[model samples]
Structures are given as C-alpha cells and as structure tokens.
Target chain A: MSVELVDVAGLDLEAEADRVSARIDDFFTSLLQPPGDSRDQLYAAMRHAAIGGGKRLRPLLTLAAARLFGIDEDQALRIAAAIEAIHVYSLIHDDLPSMDDDDLRRGKPTVHKAFSEATAVLAGDSLHALAFEILAHEATHRDPHVRSELVLELSRASGPNGMAGGQMMDLAAEGQPLDLDAVTRLQQLKTGALIEYAVEAPCIVTRLARDARTPYRGYARNIGLAFQITDDLIDFAGDEAAAGKRTGKDAGKGKATFVSLVGPDRARQQARVLVEQAIDHLSDHGEEADMLRAIARFAIERDR
Target chain B: MSVELVDVAGLDLEAEADRVSARIDDFFTSLLQPPGDSRDQLYAAMRHAAIGGGKRLRPLLTLAAARLFGIDEDQALRIAAAIEAIHVYSLIHDDLPSMDDDDLRRGKPTVHKAFSEATAVLAGDSLHALAFEILAHEATHRDPHVRSELVLELSRASGPNGMAGGQMMDLAAEGQPLDLDAVTRLQQLKTGALIEYAVEAPCIVTRLARDARTPYRGYARNIGLAFQITDDLIDFAGDEAAAGKRTGKDAGKGKATFVSLVGPDRARQQARVLVEQAIDHLSDHGEEADMLRAIARFAIERDR
Candidate 1:
C-alpha cells in the first residue's frame, strides 16, 4: 500500500530500464503482503509470480505513457501496478496444465509446478481480482470517473473480448490449421489488448477523448504486433536460457505462428517494419515520447 | 448487454424464487452473446454455466436490498448480474478437476464436462472479468464513486482476502483436524464474503456510509452463516437430486463443516437462530424489509 513518490519528471526511461524491475518488484512486494494465517501460501505464490522477476515491460510502458502526459506519479504507478498485475495473472493462468502446460517461466518453475495446480489457479484468480482492486482504489485517481474508467478499460482489455478471448482462440486453434489472419487476430486479443491498455491507460487518466487518441492507439497496436512477432522469433530460434521458457513451443505443438507462417526471415523483417511504424505513429510527439519509442525497439530487441 | 428491468419492489421474495432463475437466465443470455468464431465455445461454456439453473440467491439478495433503497431497477439488475457472474464463475472454477472435481452442477454437466478444461478455466475467468466490467459501467450507477466503491467492495470480497482466500483455506483444511472456529473462518471467506457484498451493494449504490451500515452488515453476516449452515445440513442429509450438486461431499472429503462440527440437530437449530438474528438486525426498517426477512427464513427452511 506504500507508494514510492519518485520524481517521474526526472526519471529517464532508458536509464531506468535496469531499475524498473526492482521498482516494480518493490511495488508488488508491498502490494501483496499476505494477510497471514492459512492463506499465506496463496500470497506466497502470488509473490513468487509477481515480485521476483520479469522485465516489467507492461508496467514500464504504463509509466512511460504517464510520463508523456505529466500525470501524477502516484496515479501512474498504481495504474502501472494494475496493468502489471493483469499481465502476471495472465502468465500464471497461461502456464497452467490445461493451457500452455509449461513447467517454467522467467527461468523458474511456473506457478502450477511450484505450487499445487489448485493453488496456482487460485493465486492467478486472486491476482486477477487484485488488478481491479488496484484500479478501483481512490488513490489510483482522485476523479471517480478516471477510476471507474480504468476499471472498465482494464476489465474489457483483459476479458472475453480482449486477452481472455485471445487466449481462447489460441487454445481452440492449437494443432489445427490456422492462417496468418487468424493468428494475427488471436495475438491481437491475447497480447495486443493488454499492451494497448498499457499505453492507452494514461490517456484514460488524462480523459483524452477517443477521437484524439488515434496516434497513441496506433502506436500501441503496432508495437503489440511487433512484440508478438519478436516473441515468436525468439521461440522459433533463441537460446532456452536467454528466453527463460520452453521455446519452440509453437512448433512443438505443431501450431502455426508468425515465424511458421511468414518464415523466420520475413517475420523478423515484419517485426522491424512494425516497430518502425510504431515509432512513426508517435512522430506527432516530441522528446517526451522517447521512452515509448525505445520500448517499441525493445519489443523486437529483447531476447526473451 | 440488455438489462431486464423488473419492478423489484413489487416482486414477492417467496413467490419470486421460482421466477428468479428465468429472469437471471434472460439477463445472462443477453449479456453473454459470444462474438462468433473460435471464441464462441468460451461464451458457450459461460452461458452453459450461467444461464440454465441454480437458485439465483445472491442476485436476488442484491435486488431485494436495492428495493429497500428505491434504487434504479436497471442499476439493481446490472449489479445483481455482476454478483451472479462472480458466483457462477466461482462454481465453474470450483468444479474443475483440480479443485472439487465435481461432474455435476445445477443437475447438469459441469462446465469442464461440457467443454474442455482449458475452455472452462477461460470461461470462468471471462465471467470474473465481466463482473467488474458490469460494476464499472456508467449504467450501473450515475455516480462514479458508487461504481468504484462497488468494484472495491466486490473485488475485496472475491479476492485473496476474501473468497479465494477462503477457498485456499478450505483446500488446505481437507483431511486436516479443523476446529469449529477454523471452519467458520473458512466458510466466511469462501461463501460469506460475496453474500455480504450482495446485501451491501445497494448500500454502496445509495452512498450509505460504513457507520450507517451496522445493522445491514450484521444482517448479512448472520444470514451468510445461516445460509452456509443450511447448505451443510443439506449436504449432510438432503437428496442430491434436490440439491443439484452432489451431496455429502463435505463428509466424503473428511473435511469439517458446520454439520461435522455440530450435530445435525444443533446445526439446524443454530441456522434457525441465526436466521432470527438476521431478521432482527433489520428491525429498524418497515414493510420494505419484509422480503429480506422472508429470505432469512428461507435460508434455514429450504431443503436445498
């Protein structure tokens, strides 16, 4: 519940990339303090998934977006924490035996592997609840409209029409023949929705009208695809240690992906093009958007 | 989503229990119209779990409470649907192979039996997200503060410190020597929290302060315990055909429940006492509280 009152104006995104994980970890560490007794293990699983590792890309995107608009640091960070919580929840659920069946994530045992499957499911469910809890808090924004809107947008982005919908498509399409458009739509929901929310959330906080949000949303959509392409590329051809998960999963499951459909070389080229397009969408902004631009590049550049 | 506006005030609780299912079914039917293609199965599973049966006790509680305050019928039903969505979601997840492993719910095939386990999980998660989405909607209430608080309360009720936490304790307590107090605490979270929210949501919509909610909270707590005790009694002695879900799972699992701790006669007597206490807490109100009083009695008297 403690908010670190950092000077968002003074923080440099490029410089803070290394520190972002620690900051987010600290945020989650304080945010997820167990209420003790029999439920302590639930909190422990949540902490293991939430506080320990990962690049914190989604939250960093939220912070970078908030910085672009000079939004209140506390508001931005709480929103960031909410976004990151959703991302982490999705990862935990995705790693479930009924889903991706992964044994590892962030180079450690997945939630289901480390905890009982029932505990992992409950942990993920609890974190999903916590995301809304954060967004609905008065501290997230003084304006009730902003808080409500944050809850609305976050829920929509993560719900059936968004991330959950995308995951459903992904599950249904497994081992089945799928075209490029199908995969694109699937990824757009599973990964794209949350990423778009990460960027657009600050806009919601600022109450920027939807008509005026084209550039920001375009940037989000493009980077989202770019990020997914890079992910597929890594899975298709990257070191297991570097990626910190079971790579070649798409191929192992005989599912078509960006890499499989377009081929690795063309997929990489598409990702580069998408990242460039993402940057282009932000051309209307000045140096304030530099962090967002760097993140777009990082979408393709990150080995994991 | 289409909102079916019922004149909650004119509706009689004792007479309406039979009608509540059809009304809630219509609401969920319209609410969960799945966009076509691969994701349709997810929605189908959601509809399968949400639409068909069950007593609709929780949402009925919300509607009854809303009647007390003359809140908008649409707003009331929307909130009711949100509460019901959370309830149905919990049931779906609870029946998963990893959890209670039940094959039947509402006298029909469980979600996982009707669909793949992955789809069931996603469907449950989607319903969970949909609950917040409904609460955060502008139509739920004109006041954003009301909406935000509802989100906060419901999330808190359903989150780690509430329903999920309770479920965790329930899982851990299986085959363990759980005392009466521990069983009470576990049930308080697993089932009581959401029920408490059901009675309090209208208070939130009306912006009733916490200090003013003592009687209401007391009423909720008592009825919640009464309802659970009745449920345990049913599980201990009632027919599975009448209960919808499998009976005797509590003793079958060797977990201590209200009936396990207290003799069935004492459990029944205690439930009746709690119901009286619940009705007594609402003594400050007049005829408007009659429905709630009816519900309290029904809590102890219903066979199911």
Candidate 2:
C-alpha cells in the first residue's frame, strides 16, 4: 500500500492533531510577535523556542479535556496555547548545558545551542511569564475567579513542587537506584504535574462535574507516567536518527531511568498496563474519550 | 554637635535600618525554608539572590507606602517581601553575563556568577513566579478583586513593556547615542516600573482612594528616575569599595547612560530636580511623607 493509504486509517487523529498544531503555531506567533515592536533578536529567540516543533501533546490534552466538557475549541485554544508555552519553556531550560546539556531537540538544534545561552535563558523566562500573561489576557475568561484559578493552577504545576521539583529530583537521582515508586513520583511531578494541569485546567475554569474531573485526572496521571516510561524505553531501543536525539545517551550519562531500573521488557509492560488503565478511565465517556485513549496508546507505543 | 549627640542620632537611623533589615532577612528566610517538605534548591537560589545584601529600597518603598496609608507594619511585610522578590529576580537576570554581565552585586557575587548559569536562570524564574504566588496567597486581602489586581499590576511591571522591555532597550542601546528622552524612557520602564509597583501594590490591595494611587505613582516615577540618574553619576565617580561595584564600568562599556549622554554634572542636576519633584508629590500627606522625601534626597545625594 502507498504511504498515504497506510496512514489514512488514522485520518481523524491526523486531522485533529493538525488542527491543534495550527492553533499552537498561531498562539506562539501572536505571543512572540507583539504588534509594533522592533526587538527582533529577542522575538527571534522566543519564536525559535516556541514555533515549528514538538508533538503539541500538552496542548492537545488541554483541548481534549475541554472538549469532553463541551467547551468550544476557541475557549480551549487560549489555554491550550498557554500550557504549550509553559511546556516549551520547560524544554528550553531543560536542554540548557547546565541542565541536560542536549544540543538537539525535536530534530533541530536546541534553543540554547542555537541561540546564545543568555538568549535561551531570557527566552525561557519570557515564555514562562508570557504563559501567565496570556491567561490573564484571555478576554473569554471574564470571571476573575476563573482567571485566578488558571494562574494558580498553572503556577503550581510549573513552579517548585511541579516541573521544577521533578527536575530537581531527577537531578538528585542521577546514577542513583530509583525503585518503581520513586520513579513514578518523579515522573508524576516533573511531567505528570503539567499534564495533570493541562487536563484539569479547563475543568477548573468550566466548573465541570467532579465525577468527570476525577476520571480525567486518573487517566491523565496514568498516561503521563506511561508517556515517560515509553520515552525511557525509546531512548534505550529506538534509533537515534528516528528519535531525533542520541539514543543510549541516558545510559551513557548514568542517568537513573526506568529502563535502567527494570529492563526494557518490564518497562514496556508497565507502560502497557498504564495505557490500559488510562483507557479504562474513559469507558464511561463513550466516543468522546476515544481520542484520549488512542493518544495514550500512541504515547506508549510510538517508536520515537 | 557633640560626638555624643551625633552617635545618638546615627544610632537611631542605624537601629531603624537594622530593624528594617531584619524584616527583609526574615522574609527571605521564611520563603527559602517554607514549612514542611516545601523547600527546594530553586527556592534556595531565589532566597539567596533576594536575601543577599542590597539597600532594600524597594521593600522599604512598600513599607513606606503602606504606612502612609495607615496600614499596619506587619500587614505590609508580605507585600514588601513580594516586591523584593520581583526586584531580586530582575537583578539576578540583569547580572547574567548575557545581560549586564556583572560579577558583583550589592558587594556579593551575582547569582549566575556565584551559582551555575542554569541555576541562576532557574532561580530568577522561580523568584519571579514566587512573587505572584505570594501575592495570590495573601489571604489578608479579603477582596479577591484586590488580589487579582495586585497580581496583574506586578505581572505587568515585571514582564515585557516594563522591566523586561527596559532591559531589551538598554541592551539594544549599548554603544549607541541614545538621547536624553530615550534614556528616561528606559529608566522609567526598567527601574520606574517596579518602583511604581512597589508604591501602588499596597494601595491597590487596601482599596485606597483612586486619587491616592496617582500621587504615589508620580512620587515613584520621579524617585525611580532620580535613582537611575544618581546610579549613573555614582558609576562615573564613586569608589568601588563604597559603591559595592566596579566604578566607572558604565562609561567604560560605552553604554548610553544618563551621565554619559548628558554629562555627570547635568545628571546630578537632573537627579536633584527629580528628587524635588518626587518629594513634591507627597506634599499632601504630612510627616509620613517626610521620610519618603528624605529617602529620595538620600538616594540622589549619597556618594556611593
């Protein structure tokens, strides 16, 4: 079969993904290029960090969660953009030489490696501040309560006890033996925290049913963990070219990872179980949950 | 005057300053070591950057502003702490090799130079975020609208079009012939913005008269400009030991500064005018404004 024909079965997924990606691009474009400004280099750094990359998975989760509650796509877009900004900021900082020291990201040069470290730092800082600014500026979030909650939730997720805390834990755990529980907690904080925020943020604003939120949170938590585990497994087994990053680099650096702790087979098994749990959480939602489950499964099984 | 009288007067100032300093110190210590499992190294870096030696001018402005409105000193402490965090984050990022590239700040090693650049960036990021976090957490602000407004004001002052925009302008103007107007605009955004925030935040939270905010903003604007011009003059003529920084560095770098553009004598004259204007704004408020006016004069006239 032709390549197009082989991919045609997942057309709905592809179309939704494309729509989300375009929204993200528009968001970044609007954010980085404010009208009538001539700080070209700073904007360039911001654009370089934000545009033209990533799976848009964080934003997709945000949009998906909003949809489950009947939120219009437009309402979701602003927040979707904001979460992506936070996620992009994290990745930019993570790739700094003082941190992960990676030169490449998403098949391209990392922001720090591409721009100067100073620009990278500023760009990351600007992106982070911009995320809050974006949420605050959203005309749709007229309720002060909604705006405040969004700011609080995003800040909690992105700040010390969330992404930064997880990163610190990961840094502290380098070359150390981390059991399954420890690994899970670290992943939950570092990656899952933002994911949880992404899924829960729309619900927080819309005041969705607690019953609906509970399952979405459960599904997000499992998928978030599964996403990291599968990522670890991919780093162990996937081709560097296909992955757009150096495979086995994790082991080379003596970084404590799931694959290092439990072997690839068990890591894969864990991811499978998490994906199953994630899907099970959605059984009550009918067809609306199909994209979420599919995305979770894809997160676990994707080669890269 | 007799030596005994001199000692008594100086001691009063010293004791009051010490009391204020202790408040600043306690603020840092509490934030750095929050109760329970909340402490993290990023928080430590933030505390380190913020708590280190400085004149505590911004926090003092906050305290003074609150006191002028008859607000309790204790009630003002959190706002004082939050503004200081914003100030410190600006300084930390400013001292980065990419920005000001200063090795020393307030007689101590700068954050990025003292710690890893990555840590410095993260520390600045965390502190900036923490400022809003603390503001939002201020339960004493019974009105949610007040809390939201406080957050918005601080965010705007700290983000682009305020301090960040000023830094960009400063960077771009290096080695260029920036006119006096351009220099004032830069200083207003860079320094005046936060000073304005410091003075206005308390009033905003207390729901003080809308007219009350105008004078404070005027006072802060003039004082902020005076502060920068005095700083420029100090850089031109002050000694390194007393100034706590490398003397004459601004002119040496060919950066377009107030002193460099208008000459040191003119800069000093302009600073005097600004201080007078700053004091004039507080004419409506009585003795409480005296200390604030005294501070503006001290800011301009200090040799260091």
* Number of the top-ranking candidate, with TM-score as the measure: 1
The 10 consecutive residues of candidate 2 chain A with the worst lDDT sum are A1-10
**TM-score, model 2, chain B versus true chain B:** 0.88
Best by DockQ: 1
Give candidate 1 misplaced runs (Cα > 4 Å): A1-14, A239-247, B1-11, B239-247
- Put down candidate 2 lDDT per residue, A83-170, tens digits, no spaces: 8888888898899877888899888898877877766776777677777777765463777667776777777788777787777677
Clash count, one per candidate: 0, 0
* TM-score per model over all chains: 0.93, 0.89
Give the alpha-carbon lDDT of every model: 0.87, 0.76
Model 2 clashing residue pairs (backbone):
none
Over the stretch A151-209, how does candidate 1's per-residue lDDT look in tens digits?
99999999999999999998888779599999999999999999999999999999999
